[model samples]
Target: MTSTAPVPDPSPTATTPASAASRGARSLARLGVHVVGDGVDVVVLASQASAVDLVLLGEDGERRTGLLRARHGLWHAHVPDVSAGTRYGLRVHGEWNPAAGQLHNPDKLLLDPYARALTGEVSYVPEIFGHHVTDAAATHHGLEVRDDRDSAPFVPHGVVLPASDPVATAERLAARPRVPWSRTVIYEAHVRGFTLLHPDLPPELRGTYAGLAHPAVIEHLRRLGVTTIELLPIHAFATEHAIAARDLPNYWGYSTLSYFAPEPSYATRASRDAGAEAVVAEVRAMVDALHAAGIEVVLDVVYNHTCEGGLDGPLLSWRGLDNTGYYLHDGGTPARYADVTGTGNSLDFRRQRVVQLTLDSLRYWAGEIGVDGFRFDLAVTLGRKAGEFEPDHPFLVALASDPVLADVKLVAEPWDVGPSGWRTGEFAPPMHEWNDRYRDSVRRFWLADAKALAQGGHGTPHDLRDLATRLSGSADMFHRFDRGPTASINYVTAHDGFTLADLVTYDHKHNGANREDNRDGSDNNLSWNHGVEGRVESGSPGSELRPVRRRSIRNVLGTLLVSAGTPMLTAGDEFGRTQQGNNNAYCQDSPISWVDWERTGWQDDLLETARHLLELRHAHPVMRPTRFAYGRPRSNDPFIDLAWFGEDGAAVEGSAWHNPYRRVLQMRRAGGAAANPRSAEGVAAPVRRDLLVVVNGALNDVDVALAPSRTQGWELVWDSVWESPRERHESAVVDGAFPDAGTVVPVEPLSIRFYLSR
Candidate 1:
């Protein structure tokens, strides 16, 4: 039973209007249904609605409706006998005028904007839409009339969850790895794709969050030495209409439906059957397990937009409630949305309420769900106010100042499909950005440049200079705000692009599997096919170039790890996972997207190389610096913090960096002198690493001379020419096996060598 009990006089507070449509949304702090004094306090934010009613469904399918009283732009009602797991929906009554941007439909059931748990999946039928679908003339005219069909059967219900225990939440937070950014190695992965085909997991557990936390999965990640696992979106999402029409669901989970609810699709069938609580519990368990393994979990959040598509999109959660308030729209058309995220209507961060919603969801995930951090997808959309990207936007300011997110690691995808959206190094402090320049430079140096040389082309001028800048740190892009090199999240391969193996095998993207007539995906793949186009076994015909391909992969891997930035390794890249040249496999849910666990002999060797590279990186502070390596240290340190060298072991200066055909560049650094971070005892002591990195970007071998060493000879720490990391085959490690100062050594073609002074 439901009772429309009197709402207590809430403390009315107000803030400055963020947008023109924010007139009705006046600081309604209690926007969602909350369990409070007596029974439940249901506060729905429908500032412009003429009438609002709460509908509760009984376990036996009985319904109870109660009218919510409107006050100060908020609809409020205190209901009796409401408990946890109660299924409910809202019927917001207002005129449905599409031209005027008012999409309120009294007949259609709406979802609570702050629903913590959702009960059902939205059926993408005509009934779920706001406009009349059956009426031929009405539909053609575009909202000449509203769809009067009862949408109760098509839409999902908002589920109430039991409040969290403070003690348990605190305990979870305390167990976080909290790894320093300098020492952090991120492994980007998708929960379903990570363990979907793992042979050790039970069939029932496959493709579920439970499987992601399995011992085997944890063991693999631990062995990879990745401190943080940045998962692809796990928010409750609905497959797009176009993708669903083809009977293939959205594999990337970017089309988010609800921010608070965890995606039940990635949970076990048993967990789904148990209830939404069980699904949530499964996610928490996965997080707890990852934390126990000393690994942090970071979510890829799509707050820039919702699953609801463009102007004529479906009436999901936000659309039906308050169209103009939640979404950014053109003032001229009012009905037309400002699509910045390319996923359709962009969420208006200009409004305080929307900012509040995102902040609340983040806090819930951090406090209640026990996750570490978040990576904002299409993050430029978040900083867009008045249709222009602003670095000092209030939304970003709130994030920087929020106590809940103070220590939280924030990463920005840093671009959108909107105008002038390529703002890579423009995000505020504490927000690391995905450095596309670094990715392109590394790919070009190891793949495209090699391809150019092999084809008798020298490529673009200043290519070597750009590469040298990226090798040290792209300070030209990030140093404006004094944001250090760690602000750059350097990655060559992500979930979107070609896998590490595909980068070497396919020069072009083969995305015919997407049924787009091979027109989809980017054409600018900076890749090289080593003589052949398709997969070639080790001993198969035309497989002689396989070793060359492996060399290219090793060069890229070594460069990415040895560079001065926060390196992110795409899952399966360490062992050369491929997508059969399907770069944009967003619709692929089969083996094309899942990480193949079956390893070949060469793949085992590649994995060992990745492990060795990570070990070297972690052991030496010179490889990863928190501040810029080019810092003018406040302390009087004699060691040169950073220095670049040419093939002659001399400093690379002036126009010499612009030589495109100049394939050899060396970087040398001393530990503790770069950033000069004080020791735990507040003393700046000399760090004990004499690191030197040499890369030969040419297709042919070259002899490079070792730099002058004060104490002793240079030790052979690592070289990309070694097919196996442990088994040097022909080379030896350190101690007289290495050459003395100023000695020229034969550097392999398309390889990088790491040396430490003995």
Candidate 2:
């Protein structure tokens, strides 16, 4: 829980050589390719290279190479007469000892990790690999060999960005939508998938960043009440060799190549054809447009590892630059990478240069590109120092302390494949974590529990206590470290797993199209098909099944929105979009992955239900408590912040929490007392309405007695039983008000109800 000291900055300094001093003096005090004065200054961190050369490709296809002066682990040079729009790459000459983790080859063109814009696509051919064609067998056998083939024809080259106009950049930052964390409702989406099928967007703009900024897209997000759009990785990434060979792309974009550049493919074809600078401007325009619409943008960044796989992988940017310094190699054998991320190689956070690179990339995106925050993919690896995850690792501390980054949102995935990597709720304060436990518990409560009940099971596999804990902000996991409810990003479904529609439509994943023969994705999905597997046609013989499935979806959505935490809704889940039961659709980039604008009658209803749930969340602050509710009123206060009760209107106690058969529970939050809750700064905050949420996980309808309280009356505000929004809202208000105590309420089977106390 203690804060770690900030890592000291290791700025590059000039050495005794006059050339090094001259180059350092002229270079701007920033990393990457920058236009300084009359020439472009290139700075690269090549710690272990014997020689570093700046290779430039002219428009006429002429190639020129210049040696860079090295000093203190950094290579620096000022190329005269060179300006922005110049295409460039790096060539680091070093030993080819694969056993010792050195796979440098000057013949293989390398990318600049700090490249602001990258042009061309990486053609994954055998020439791209570092090992010789004949010695390729040796690589399989764990031996090192050099490949003499040139990779210049197939590699992506960095394009020097035009000098950033400080005034323009400032204006863009000034226009950003700095949404507060407490008010943030993140909608995790893909830059391409989100608008790919939008009927209103122009065909050219579809699947591009510009398309995401279209008015129709903005209106939809606004209608759904999303504060931030957490985009899937748009960083310049390479399709994995195997996936590409199979004619499949890395759709999720977890494999990042150039951290600074936006993926050019996400830009319009016109922008791409115009070159990298145009692509950069297109992304900026998207951010600006979203900001104008009052929506913050958060990138899902992959800093845990690079596109380069293990020793047998291609010699891309990092692996060829300085393998030992950039990546963590096996302790016993330096040649092999320590695969903590299951991505072949984990970035070495122990090295200051690697840490600097990550920090620099973050700052560039936040500062230059005008992004609001980042959701780190496989974030646990970033906190791993000396082979174990630490809450206060130096890199983490630096991130939390950085002037530019500290104010922005920092969400962590919170787990990896490394030893003891599941550190959910263990990260330090200000670091919100994705709550997988919450996802599982909610799924079990609604979907799995219903399935078990239909199978003649006695009760749920687990009691309602876990569900209650998660609904009340997961205090057991986060509160020990003084983190508040907002620290837990509550979600029922994310992009990695089954969609909300699929959760109630399929019991098992249908991943046969992934070419893995239905073996990929998680087995323990906690999903239930609700009496029928796969998609069930409307008006089928099993007509009752559709109603059950729709109610199940509402149950999960209600729990997520009414729960105490920041709620994140997957993009297509709002309208019941499904990948046809494909849980792991990371590689399916076709129509299967895109958000179809075409909707069924049920889908429209589902979308309306989702909107209503989000509206309720925003209207009632008790559902999103800033602090953990302990069921005790403040000093001399007549109302309790939160209280739980049983079906008989009595306080829940003892085995009642462990009773699996007891599926009905009532929770009441003190609206009057919460009207003016105290803020962290000790200021009197705005008043929030008190609410009572009733949940019934049983298969049959039951009468629930309202909990005894001092409130004057309770009015039914929302119910999940309604099939349409008109039905839900028109008959939302109960005819008669209930007394403070001893009132039996008719609760539906497997549904939730919300009441506002007056």
Candidate 3:
């Protein structure tokens, strides 16, 4: 990749952790080094060494050794003759000290930091593991002995390639489809699982890189009205040690090994030599195809930690090259790793070189791979320094300033296992964060409390008002920043937790299938199993849960899409796909997490309802909040335009904030100047009131008085109470003032309704 900035100031101190490897190796006769890019020709310089040799390997496994060129305090070689596609590794001649983090046995071949392609999967072995012990307890602390066995046979070798014009590639890709934050609808999906069960995909292409670029995949997204597809982590990851022993793999792709290369396992035709580059090109082509159809691709990235485990972890690229420099080490000792990422060691951003490495990797993916955006996994770790998490951390600041990545979508998981980890709305402006409040509030209002509301006579109006606040772009969370409604990414479920289907079917997490003994998932799900837990008998009306489950799904899904801010839907939620009660299926690559393309008769109706809701969102400008709405901007409007109303249609007062049974939410998205004064819909210019959304979450029927509009006619645009197609009524109701606003509209328990003034 082409860097706009001048080469980072040449360092004199070698204060960086890699200094240890350089100092120790120089004293030995076998230590050797060579520079490939912008410097002097071959010249070997050794002050205390007995001998040194440079080793370069090619695709045919032939090794070429030459004397290294000596430069200012280091060996140098300008191999402009060595074009791209060269596969090479380093063999340092030095002492193998296990305690000093400098294990240069010369038998272990190391990967290059700038390598673009990796030949195969990096297999873990006792020799490559930092420790010398076969015992589990001794290795856990990272103090293990070094084995003499050659790990090169099992280790994946990095491939070199000729440099390409990164600037031109970025320019063309940037011009592709890039919907603004407000208009973007994210569809979170696993590349393999998404198309693995897709019957329409070609047999040869199914579950591969080619399958994602297929027309059928594009059509499905187009019909769903998705602006971006948020793919799960695609970087090459490893199966956890425990899972490997159990014969299962890390299905979520969280353990990243190669940051620049895509996983070759997902490709159909693979070659040990150029397979990674081919897969990268194919994935890039998929992005191009999606862009042509007006869709963007956002990768879920893992940068908090590498596939390398704690202390006794495998010596992959980072550890093999420079363990102390790549990972955050203790300030006093420098040997102990700072375990902030929870998944072993955290990447040390304190060093400028480390920060550059991360930014360089990000630029390579965005500029070279052609992705539209990235959702940082455990973003809190990225902002963390030695002691505190700074919002203006260099990595984030650099990313925001870089020309190629500045315009691309930047999302944050926003929390980590570190101290004070929940920084939801704390991201800098222009960065949208996942809204957990929206998810929790929607769940409590629609599903959990629906049972009490159905029994009648006890629910309050405060609950409904709070629900409306989340529906209004979570103004409380983003109200502090200039970033409008686009700051919140609203959703009911995400990949880390339960699927939407499981949210209603099971009251608690069923993760025994994960082999973690049901110990890996969350406990506070706030889910309500209507009557029987898990799946009930088919067509058995005997369970009171049937109607309630259906109603809850409709209300939550409707609220998510119609609510302010961008909405993200987990794949398979539209068709009611379930994990069969398993909440955490991170280790299961099978059908458990895959979308079951075949749906039951009733499920088809649910899918249609989801489609209709998305269509309605596209049809109405009010549902998609272009700008955040501040309550009552106009003094003349009696209702405050977007006022909170009690069940009686009166303005809710002080006591409503804590009301548990409150199940009626009324929103008058009126007030604000419309930009287009000539549009027939009157939405072009923000007039006083364009749309009103009334949500009823009670179990028994309740009469909600719609505010009587004297000047306009009220028409029903969409209702989630009834099934699709027959869902909305054709005419308008001209009801006069409050108490008797409209006809006694019976809002079924856990239902959402949308009305527009004609």
Best candidate (score: TM-score): 2
| Candidate with more favorable, higher TM-score: 1 or 3 | 1
What digit string (tens of lDDT, one per residue) describes model 3 on residues 1-758?
11111222222312233433344354322122222354212333222222233445664664544333233223433333454555565444433444555444345665555455667666655655544546422335545345556667766666554455658686657666878886889999998898998899877777877788899988988987888999998877777565666667889999887777677777756432345557667777777888888989899999888877776666655665456667776654425677877877888777665676677777877887778899998888888887578889888788789887877899988888877888888888656899998888888777666644444634442355558788888888876667788789998898867777788888888887777778887887867777568877667754666666776787788889888988999998987888987877888998898888888876888888888878877777767876666565554333444556655666666777567656676777763444555577644443533676777766557787775543355567667766663545322233322223454566665677777666
Q: Estimate each model's TM-score.
A: 0.93, 0.94, 0.86
Candidate models: Cα lDDT each = 0.82, 0.83, 0.69
After best superposition, candidate 2 residue 263: deviation in angstroms?
0.2
Q: Write the per-residue lDDT of candidate 1 for residues 698-731, one digit (tens) a residue.
A: 7778888776664467778888988987755357
Q: Which ranges of candidate 2 are over 4 A from the true structure?
A: 1-20, 25-29, 134-143, 458-460, 635-637, 672-688, 729-740
Q: Arrange candidates by lDDT, highest first: which order?
A: 2, 1, 3
**Per-residue alpha-carbon lDDT of model 2 for 1-758, expressed as tens digits?**
11112222222321224655676766534667788677677788777776777777886763544445456678776666678888889877777777677677877889989999998888877678777654222233443557778888898999998888889878988998888877889999999998989999999999999999899999999999989999999999998776776678899999998999999999999999898999999999999999999999999999999888777778889988888999987676545778999978899899988898999999989998999999998889999888989889999999999998877899999999999989898889778999999999999989887789889994546788999899899999989678898999999999888999999999999998889888889999999998778887777876778888898888899899988889999998988998999999999988778999899888898888888888877777666788888888856355788899888889899988988878888888775454447878998764445788889988898888877756566777677887766674466455354445568877889989888776
Pairwise lDDT winner, candidates 2 and 3: 2
Q: Residue 358 lDDT in model 3? A: 70
Better of 1 and 2 by lDDT: 2
**What residue runs in model 1 are displaced by over 4 Å at the alpha carbon?**
1-28, 70-72, 134-141, 458-462, 631-636, 673-687, 733-736
At residue 290, what lDDT does model 1 achieve?
A: 97
Model 2 RMSD in angstroms:
5.7
User: Of the candidates shown, which would achieve the greatest lDDT relative to the real structure?
Assistant: 2
